[model samples]
Target chain A: MDFLELDAVTKEYPNRSGPPARVMDQVSLSVRQGEFMAVLGPSGCGKSTLLQMAAGLLPVSDGTVRIAGRRIIAPPPEAVYVFQQYTRSLLPWRNVRDNVGFAIEHRLGRRRAREVAEAQLDQVGLEGFGDHFPWQLSGGMQQRVAIARALAAEPAMLLMDEPFSAVDALTRLDLQALILEIWARRRLTVLLVTHDVDEAITLADRIAVLTRRPARMAEMVEVGLPRPRDAVATREAPQFLALRRRLLDRLLLRHDG
Target chain B: MTAERLLRPLPGLCVLALILGGLEAAVDAGLIRRALLPPPSAIAPVLWDMLASGAVLPPLLATLRLVFAGFFIGSAIGVAAGLAMGWFPPVFRLLEPVVELLRPIPKAALVPALMLFLGIGETMKITSVALAVLFPVLVNTLQGVRGVDRVMLDAARTHGWGRAHTLLHLVLPAALPFILAGMRISLGLALVLAVLAEMLAGQGGLGFLILDMQRSFLVRQMYAWLVILAVLGLALNALFLLVERRALHWQPALRP
Candidate 1:
């Protein structure tokens, strides 16, 4: 059985002066255990909405999201959501260390949580910057703190919604490399949503292509790439180019329509 | 950095000196009546005498006591109510109409009503100050709590933080700038209402003394008390600014 399953998921929002408007249409996808799956789509697509549903942060209008064979009603303890807007997501009042500790501080006392946060920070290459506030760090560093926070939760799954889209290109590449390393080390199931074609192919074990608004999963293409991917070499390969072209063409078709 | 900090206020201090000098010149030249406005030099000695003789302590402490009690009580109630109203829809709906109606009527006008109920005592005076302090704080805190980023709230939920934990750690801190801004405005109102209540009640604080001295035609003493009140206001405002900057040190725009 899939580790996470979205079964015939549909989402609708109440309109100001009309019937409910649909944003996601009967989308169903499944993520296997220990897989790095990327949900790629055009801008303003309901990819993030689907990811939120799978994480159980949003109530599904007409379907069930099951994690570990259990129907998800709220955020399950085995999963954590990493937000794209790291600046807003992090508590500015908290130092980098405390923010990372936020995930486990309730279970573990402050002292124990801080120690765990420090270890997570080290993994994310943010050692010795624990005392600094989020505003004191650069955009990339702040996102690293956010990633550390997600990792500190020690969940079997990580749900990320366009997590690195806000940083500079060079910073984005660095983050991409960092994520690949983390994934290899942790062997955690990841469902990352993104609008970037290159990012989807570069990091994901499989790419789930999505259609435009009121979107549904179009197809799931296996990346079939080797483990421990490099930023430059991975992109330069033939398979990466072929997969990028196929996904871009599919997405562009919807854009043209 | 120390030099920069010291020099920061030089321009404002210079302007203040120029205004005081101009007022003194006008009074000395008889263009302004000394009976109406005492020169800085004349009031300076009286202020020094009051301070040195420890006569400044009583009235100063009394007024300070009223302001502090009202400000703290009012701020605490306002924050609690505001967070509830902002966080929970039912609470907001229940309180919205009553708050809007009560908020607009000047709290000073409520002073007479308060005096009628509580009579001319410290209770009446502090209550009046608290009423003045409450609404601004309540309104600002509500705004702040409501304006908290939705993403952050979602983050809190995903982290498995319960409602109480979220309110105390996440929601409260996120809304702090708004809460503090409201409290800053209320601090000034707290003092104003305290002084006003004291005068109206014919009480023993600085306000009453200023009024009493003027009526008795002790012009110098009245100006002297007025000067003390002005200095008190300036000191309180300076202290609040210092604390506010420190509390919001992490905010980039608020960094000192």
Candidate 2:
């Protein structure tokens, strides 16, 4: 049985003065326990809509999204979605630690929540930013704070929607490495949606390429890179280069068509 | 930047001083009618006497009590009602007509009716002030609540936070800047209504005192009451600003 499942999901957005537009059609995917799966597609291809359904942030027009044998009708307690727009996601009214702690605050109480937030902030290499507000931090650091916030809930799965697309190239690489390190450490079921082929190749166990809207799975490419891989070494490897080239050719060919 | 910051308010303060100085000079030089606009120097002595004789305390206390009571009462009702209406469409639909109908009727127009029902007493005075404060707070709150970022609400939902929890922890905090702004506007309106209530139908208040002093040809005492009224308004607004600064310290400073 898959740890996370999306079975024949479809989404239709009703227009006030026009026919309802179907954004995505009959999408199905499954992720095993402790696997990193990346959904790669061009921008505006319903990648975010798919992730939103799995996280129960948006309702599916048809079919079920399930995690751990349970259908997700509402946002499940055991999974958290890390949004790509970190600036919008993190509360400006809260300092870094408080924003991270906000999710679990009610359950743990303030003191313990602060402690949990501190621990997560440390994990994200933001040990001294507990007092700093979101506006005070750089974009990359703010995203790290968001990642820490997602971790604070101690979710079994992380649904990430192009989490690094907004950052600079070097920061994106660094964040990709961070995600890999965290997944390695925690053995989490991670479903990442992105447009970057190299990011999927570098971090994902398998990459699911989605076609343009109405999006559907075009191909599922398995990554054969070795585990505990160094970022520079992995990218330089023959297998990595070959996979990257193949995915790029496929994506570019689709774009041209 | 540091020098610019220090110099920013200097021009405004200097202008204010010059205006006051000019008014005093005009009165001293007998260039302007003193009855219409009393010199700042003469008014200070009369205000001191009123304070020393302790005749000012009762009216000051009366005005403060009414203003504070009305402000708090109106704010409580406005915030709760606004939030409820904003979050739920049904609540808004049910109550929106009543709000729309009542909101536009000049609050002063309602005073005679309120006076007839409640009598010329504290209840009437408080209710008048409360009515004046209510609309602005409610409107601002609704705007604030509706303006909450969609993403923040989604974030809360994903955490399994219920409606009540979300309202308190997420919605209220997001709506705070709007709420405070509304409250500040209501503060000024509240003071106006308080004084107006006294003027219209009052047994005793600062408004009554000012009128009585003027009628008796005690010009300096009348001017003194005006000064007190101005100072009171300034003090309340300053206090409200302090509260706003403390509450919204988390938000980054916005440039005008």
Candidate 3:
């Protein structure tokens, strides 16, 4: 059974003067428990809009998003969104530990929240950097804090929108490795949005290629690369190379042709 | 560390001393009449006596009380209204016209009107000072609130933060720097209004004494009260800066 499902979801942004601009045509997708699904598309392909709607952050102009067989209109307690701009999402005024704790503080209060936050920080390899503010941390570390914040909420589903796209290539690899390890340990169903073909091939259980603007799901390709994957070896796999080429062809056709 | 802080002002003090010494020399040489511009040497003794005897407390306290009261009242209302206006469209729409109508009118010009209603007492003076402090704070807070990053608000929503949680933890801290800036600008205006209101009131505080002494031909005493007012202004500004830095320790511009 699908743990999270986006059923024929369509998004249209209503403009002030003109008619509503359609962002995504009816796109259906579903993720089983403990599955990692990556939505691969070109830039400005409404990938973020799809993820946001699934997270219940943006309302779908058409269709329903169901989590655990229940339709969700607002952000569900079982899911959390990890934003791309980690710098903006992590409150600058708050230290790293406090920012992580922000997710659960209202429920657990300060002292308890800090203990939980520390454990989450440890899980994300940010153990000794708790008291440091977001502005003091590197971009990669800040994103780890953002992930730690989502983990502290103890969400069953993580909706990530190009979370590591801003970090350096080396840092992005480290983050990808970190997230995969965490995802396995926690049994989380993750829907990661990205434009990078290699990222989709390396991380996802299945890749959903989206066509550009008012995007529709062009194809869903199953990533058959063996589990217990490492970032270094995953890219060079014959299967990984094939999937990457196929996605690139599908994504680049409208641009070059 | 403390020594460096203490020594930092030495240069400005030296400049002040040089100017004072020049004035004293001119007075002693009889190039300037003593009645018109008394030497700093002559004014110093009166200042010392008033401070030593605690005679400066009454008027000093009166003016300070007015400034503090007006400042707090005005700031509290300004921040509250600014948040409401920024967060809610109806509040902004309803209050915009009235606020705009009142905000642009020079606050000092309202003194006669305040006197007409509140009489020539503390009430009139405080109302005048508070009016001066209100608009800048309100407008700045509104700007700050509106300027809050869209991503931050979106993050709050996705993280399961409720309206009050978002307002207190997110909205207020985000707008604090702007609110404090408005308060800083309004602090100087508050003092201006306090002094002007006191002068117009003509019955209490240092402003009255300064004007009264000059009219009474007590030149050194007038200058003495004037020094007290100057010190008062300097002290208030320094105190505000210290508090502002403490409150916004996270801000880059405010870092030491």
Query: Can you write out model 1's per-residue Cα lDDT over A16-103, one digit (the tens) per residue?
Result: 9999999999888889999999999888889989989988899999988999999999989999999999989999999999999999
Task: Give per-candidate clash totals.
Answer: 0, 0, 0
In model 2, what are the clashing residue pairs, if there are any?
A: none
Best candidate (score: DockQ): 1
Task: List DockQ, one per candidate, in order.
Answer: 0.76, 0.73, 0.73
Candidate 3 chain A: worst 10 consecutive residues by lDDT? A248-257
Model 3, which residues run further than 4 Å from truth? A14-19, B1-15, B21-33
Residue A169 displacement (Å), model 2:
2.4
Interface RMSD of each: 0.8, 1.1, 0.9
lDDT, candidate 1, equals 0.92
lDDT of 3 at A213: 81
True contacts kept of each: 0.71, 0.73, 0.65
**Native interface contacts retained, candidate 3:** 0.65
Single out the weakest 10-residue window by summed lDDT for candidate 1 chain A: A224-233
Tens digit of per-residue lDDT, candidate 2, span B1-256: 9999999999999998899899999988999889877898888888899899998899999999999999999998889989999998999999999999998887878889999999999999999999988988999999999999988888888777789888988899999999999999999999988988998897788988888888898888888998899999999999999889888987767511
**Ranked by lDDT, top first:** 1, 3, 2
lDDT of 3 by residue, B102-146 (tens): 999999999999899999988888888888999999999999999
